[model samples]
Target chain A: MKRNVRSSLGLVVVGFALLTSGMAQAAETYKMDTEGSHAFIQFKIQHLGFSWLLGRFNTFDGEFVLDQKNIENSKVKVTIDVASVDSNHGERDKHLRGKDFFEVEKYPEATFVSTRVEKTGEKTAKITGDFTLKGVTKPVTLDAEYIGGGKDPWGGYRQGFEATTQLKLKDFGIDYNLGPASEVVDIYISVEGIRQ
Target chain B: MFINTETQYGVVSIVLHWLSFLLVAALFGVGLYMVDLTYYDPLYHELPQWHKLFGVVLAVLSLARILWRILSRSPTILAAAGWQVAAARSVHWALYLLLLLLPLTGYLISTAEGSDLSAFGWTLLPGLFELSPALADWAGSLHLWTAWGLIGLATVHALAAFKHHFVDRDSTLIRMVYIKGQ
Candidate 1:
């Protein structure tokens, strides 16, 4: 009985040590500071064959895990309120949210969750993720550049990133016929995260 | 026959006049069709862009016509009473004014609604005005009213031309229709 007890105690000690070491090596979690941080997500699409129509989403929330040691293990997830789309025109915005476009009433939220992170440079990485938009999910890759990370005046650690990707509106089930403008759309995301 | 003579229109004048008439007529048709398009129409997005494209082209062409008229001498009016001459001149001048005013109001409405004027695939003008629903609505109404005025004037002008050709049995219609030295 004493031998069994000793073996069980040894296993418990080993498990505790492994758990603590794993925790130390795990990535740092960052909560999005929606008020203090700014998340600018802009999209540009061709207007006819002439100019690019620029627009942006006004509301979004996201969080990310940064494993500075093993950057490949970092993960990011973003949730965008699809109804917050604005193109500086009320009628256009309303039209966009209708069935022919985003159909925000039916699919009110869009989300992106990173599946893989490929480090390309010292400050740049390619983040591949599954993006759910308008009830459809597709894999998208974004070129992300880590701006910097430092402690803020409020005594919180913060990190900034800028990511860009090109997507086809048709892929998201937003296949409105814009003639020559019905091509690919460029998406830009600039976000800052605060360490939780 | 490149310049206008007292007897008939020259090549340049004839070409500009016919081109403007055809384009303006087509624009009026397109404008009428596009305004009735609903948000659910498949052409809701595309038709407006095309309308704006044609509107800009018409505006540029009308300006050129005005400049040409100013720089060159036009054929003298056929012999008529003082009141007939006055009525014809007023109608012609009103048509010119509407040509300018209609496009200007359209541009204002489009720009105010936060849309640029593009020609085919080329952007000629950007949306420069601050977005205001009220301003867009006002400009749209003006554009519609001006379009109606243009249609009415054009119809009267056409009827008068036919009357001069068939009823009055004069060279008033022939002067613009037949080229000089033809």
Candidate 2:
């Protein structure tokens, strides 16, 4: 029994060491193609005397880190300039940046940092993370699916990922319309990254 | 001396005040509502257009109101309890700024962020500026935050009006209201 235990322990240690060495040696950098990426933040509120109003945040920047061989070793970082909140109107956007809501002067940036990733398939992943906006942070999960990945004719690895997530603007310290603007804000993202 | 205005405001003041109120309220409601509808409904494609149209109307009304306020003399309130008068002024100013800022920022953010210059099918407005991803992002954030600010101001305004109407039994509400009499 002791011999058997020793052999199992030895195998586990060897496996761990091999995995660590592989990760250390195989670090690949991915470059995000901003032109090919889409970032939109959505919001909704009660309409005048009726239903809910809907819209999206029109501008954002996306960041991605990926290794083709080890898909598990991927990371995504997205930064949304809070000052960019647009719902296709000028006056509304200005109000959003002022004191009662985003207070953009104090908190200029809204950011998302991924925590854990669960691969659902060869091309789909469930990423969980914390999204902070207007000084409020909340756990958000995105359904990320790999659209397609391939090597370009120039020999650079290109990967495409699409992710979608939703949250309440109020969660981010943007508790503007308590019951007027529906508390929920849905976000959608589609990205195409290239390995540098 | 904490008395209300002796007479009703002029026709222009009444129109501008009510129009501005309705428009600002609509802007806030519509702006916040649009955030989520685009996600689930494909038919919601027209929403951006509506936002643009209403935004322009609000902007124009707000500009006109500002001009009118500047050009004409508005009825002055009789000396009020210090806190009530200060609160009223602050809320009114905040609402005015929000009315102007929200629409302008939304327009700039929409136009500058991309080439979708014709907010709706309307070509009345200039679709001149091109959108920069960075600038668009910044403008978008600013717009959203400003919206929240508007919401806050609105809440205060509504609450104050309610206080005058129900709690304080004051004429502040009556002055703002367009009914036959208090």
Candidate 3:
């Protein structure tokens, strides 16, 4: 009985060592095609319980790993500059970046690092990640769909995807009280990556 | 002349008492109204600035008031029961504590996101710490609850004074308000 416990403890130590040293990955890494201006992170929400107001973050970069044989092993990491939030209207954008909304001067960046990726269908997956925004980190899930991958005209191999998610403004520490109707914002993203 | 005697409040004590109470009342009223305003309202931004401005004023005044109370003698309670004396002492201590607590917690919440707290074109407290969301949330909860606690205790304190004047027919309330020596 004691020998059995000894072997179990040995296995636990070995597992911890493997996790710290980074286990071998069987996925291909791809860099986001941000230089070509082919990526988008946009959001929309109800404006004053009457109309929809749309906005997008213009500057961000990310990378993803795709295991073709097993999609569950895929990983994604993205960093977005919160100061780049643009609603097209200059005056409103100024207010959005101020103390009322994002407070970009204080919290300059928002980031997402995937913790789990589960393949739900042949072309769809659920990506759960820890998303940090406005100095608060919360777990968020994105419903992602895989698009086609092909060789571009510039002679580079590329893969494309689209995803959607929703976030509560107050949950991210943005408690500016924009009324009950504007509580949640719908996020839409289209990412195209180049094989590296 | 500014020090309290055996049976009467000093001029300084009376002034501090009225000033702090008036400040607390104004701050609490403005705080309740400001937190509920929508983003579109002009007062949404204006009120918080004033709130923090006055919060700084209260923080300094409350500290000075506590110091003065410690350095001076308090007038003896007249026509009071044993339980009333103890309750009044406890209530006075709690009021002073909460008065200081509101601003301390407000400082933590305001500076949590790495921004210095500024009031009336001057920086009151520097953001010496980094961004701390957990501390910010904790302080925010404390600030909200303590505001109500302070107001509740102040009401009880006032009622106690009224009880002394009306029910007990004593000179307790009059001593604090009415001044002598021209």
Best by DockQ: 3
Per-prediction DockQ scores?
0.05, 0.07, 0.07
Q: Which structure is stronger by TM-score: 2 or 3?
A: 3
Model 3 C-alpha lDDT per residue in residues B32-146, reported as the tens digit of each score:
9987677789897788889999899999999999999999889886744698788788889999999989999888766765668876677888867633333455577699899
Query: Which is superior by lDDT, 2 or 3?
Result: 3
Native contact fraction of candidate 2?
0.09
Better of 1 and 3 by lDDT: 3
After superposition, candidate 3 runs with Cα above 4 Å error? A1-65, A68-196
Tens-place lDDT per residue, model 1, B1-182, is: 78887777777877878888888888888878966676458886687777777788788888888888888887777646788878888998899999999998887765665667664577878877654444554576799899999989999998898888898898778777766455
Which wins on DockQ, candidate 1 or candidate 3? 3
Chain A accuracy as TM-score for every candidate:
0.86, 0.72, 0.86
TM-score of each: 0.50, 0.47, 0.58
Candidates sorted on lDDT, descending: 3, 1, 2
Q: Scored by CA lDDT, what does every candidate get? A: 0.82, 0.69, 0.85
**Which stretches in model 2 have alpha-carbon errors above 4 Å?**
A1-27, A35-59, A68-70, A153-155, A178-181, B1-182
Pairs with backbone N, CA or C atoms under 3 Å apart (clashes), candidate 3: none
lDDT of 2 by residue, B1-182 (tens): 11223455555676677787777677677767766553246535566677778888888888888777667765554335787677677777777888788877777776673444465466636656755444655667788898888878778877877876788776556666663454
Candidate 3 true-interface contact recovery: 0.17
Please name the candidate that would achieve the greatest TM-score relative to the true structure. 3
> What is candidate 1's lDDT per residue for A1-196, written digit by digit as tens?
9999999999999879769876533687887767754778899988766888999988889899999888899999999988778788755765676677888767989999999999999999999999999999999999999998899988888888999999988898887777755468999999889888
